[model samples]
Target: MQKFNVTPLLVMLGALGLTACGSSEQEEAPQSTKFSLGVSDAPVTEAAAVVVCFSGIQLVGNDQPPQSFTLGQDSSAADTNDLCRDAAGNVIPNTRGIDLLQLQGAASEALISNAEVAPGNYGQLRLDIAQGSYLQRLDGSRHPVQVPSNQLRLNGPTLSAGGTFSYTLEFDLRKALVDPVGIPGYFVKPTGLRLVDNSEIGHLEGLVAESFLINNQCNVNPADERAAVAAVYIYEGLDLPIAELADNGGTNTHQPYASTAVFFNNDATEYQYAIGYVDAGNYTVAISCDTTDDPENPDEVNFIVTKNITIEARQEPHQLDF
Candidate 1:
C-alpha cells in the first residue's frame, strides 16, 4: 500500500452578540450593531506552520460606506491580542498574525470582540492581508505565500438587529493553496473558500481501529508518532458511492466537502481524525489507507471503510469509527 500524507486548511470565523446601538439625530443613518469574530483552522501535512497576517477587515453592504477595522486599534479581544505580536513580543500595529496549524479541530483564536458595525445585509467581507505571509516546511525551509490581490473577498451574511449570529469562513487549502510552475513562492487562490453560518454547523470525530489498518495493509506507525498514512473523506450527502467520491478539486462532480488526515493519538492509544465546522446535514464518510489524493487532480483511491452519518446543528460531535 502506498502511504499518502494528507493535510487540509480551513478558516472558520464565528460572529456573535450582535446588539443594536442607541440611535440619535440621524434617522436616515443605519443602526449600528455589535459582533464578535474569531478564526480557526484544520491540520496540514509537510508544513510546520502556515502564518497569515491580516491587516484589516472590511464589510461592504446596503450601499453604505464600507466599515473598516484595524486589528489592534479596533476593539480587539484582549486574550488573543498577543497572537498579533511580532518576534520581539510587541504587537504589530495593524496586523494580526495567526498560525493556522496551531488551531485544529474545534479550537479557535479570537480576532475582534464586541466590534460594532452597521446592522444590515452584508454582501462582501474583505480580509486585508499583509505582506510576509509564509509557510514553513517540516524541513525548516520557509517560502513566501502570495495573495493575488492582497485581499480575500468572501460572501458575507446578513446581520439583523437584536440578534446574535455566528458565521465561519472555511478555506480548503488543499485546493486553494498551490505552487506555480516557475514561481518561487506559493499562491493562495479563492477557489476553495466557503462561508457558512456557525449556528448550523457541527463537528465530527472518530477512531480508526488497529485491526482495520492491518487488514488494509496500512503502515501502522507508533501510537506516539504523527504520520499521515491514512485519511477520511467527507461528502455532503449520505450513501454516496465510493467510486464517485472526489478530492478537493473543482472539476470533480463529487468533490469532498471536507477532509482530514488520520493519525495515531498517543493519549488515546488509537488512530483518530476530527473535522470541525461542518454544516449540519447528512454526509457520507469514507476511510482509505491507499490515500494518494491530489487536490489538484482526480486520483483513483481505494476505500476500506464507508458509512453514512447525520450531523445536527449545535449537537455533540458525531463519531463514526472503522
Candidate 2:
C-alpha cells in the first residue's frame, strides 16, 4: 500500500475547533438539508452538457471542536470524491474548487478568501469529470445552460452554524463544445455533505510526478504566440487538487526548484500553470529557489536543483506491497 497523506500540513492544522456560531440559537438545533442528485449525459452529438441547480446553502460549524463533511459515502476525500448533487438534482464537487478544500481543518461561516466558487447560494461546490469531453448548455429554455466560470457570482450570501438551504445548476455540452463555454480544466463534479472530522485521510493519490514532453504539438494560435504553456497538477489522479507540482517540479512551494505561476511576480493574477518543455523534461529549465531569473527581462540562469527524475508508470497512487 502506497503511503500518502497531507503530512506537510498536519502541524499547521493543530487543535482545530469550531470557529463561530450564528444567532439562531438553534431554538432547537438548526436543521440541515441533504441534497442528492443523479446526473447523466446525452448521446454524443456536438458535445454539450447540463448543470444542476442549487439554492439555500448553509454552513454548519460549531464552537468547541472543528468539523468536516464527507461526500455521499464516507470517503473522507477532498474534492476528488466528496461531490454533492442538489435537492433539485445537479452534481457539484463538495468543495469550492480544486485547491480550496483540504483534508482536516476548521471550516468557518465566513466567505473563503480567493475561494473558487460560482457566485450564488454555494457552500463549497465543484464539478468532476472522468476523461471524456463535457459540453455546454446555452439557455435556460434548456434544462441547464452554459455559464462562464468568471461570470458565476452570488446574489446574497449569509452562512451560519447548522443552517441549510437548497440550490440549482445546469450544464450544456453544445456551448462547451463550441468556442466560449469553457469551465477551467480543474473543475470537477460536485458531491454533497461536508462531514465534520479531524482524522486525516489521504490527500492526493495518483501519479505524483508525471512529466510529459509532447513534440510536434499543434498550436491554437500560431500567429500571435510562439509557444504554449501547460501544467501537471496533483490530485487523487482525479480533478481535485492535492498539491501543485509546477512544470519545474515544485513541492507545493514556490521555491526555485518549482513554481506554480508560469510567469514570475504574476502569482497573484497569473494562473498557476506550467509550460511543457521541448523534450517534455528538457528545455530551458527553471527552479524558483531564489527569484534569480527575470521573466520579462532576460538574465543569467542557474540550476537551483535541476534533478533528472525517472520512474516507472503504472496505476498511480501506487500500492505498497509488504
Top TM-score: which candidate number? 1
Q: Scored by CA lDDT, what does every candidate get? A: 0.72, 0.24
> lDDT, candidate 2, residue 157?
30
* Segments in model 1 whose C-alpha atoms lie over 4 Å from true places: 1-30, 77-92, 222-226, 250-252, 290-292
TM-score of each: 0.82, 0.20
Residue 213 of model 2 has an lDDT of: 18
Q: Which stretches of candidate 2 lie over 4 Å from their true place?
A: 1-28, 37-72, 75-124, 130-167, 179-322
Write one digit per residue (lDDT tens) for candidate 2, span 1-322: 9986776566445423122233334454544433322122111121123232222122222222212233332332223232223345455544322111111111122112122222223333333222222224323122222233423322223233343322222121111222223534323222111221112111111111112211212112212121122222111121222223232223333322222212111223221222111011211223322222222233332222222232122212222110
Error in Å for residue 314 of model 2: 50
Displacement of residue 138 (Cα, Å) in model 2 is 21
- Kindly provide the TM-score of model 2 when superposed on the true structure, using C-alpha atoms: 0.20
Best by lDDT: 1
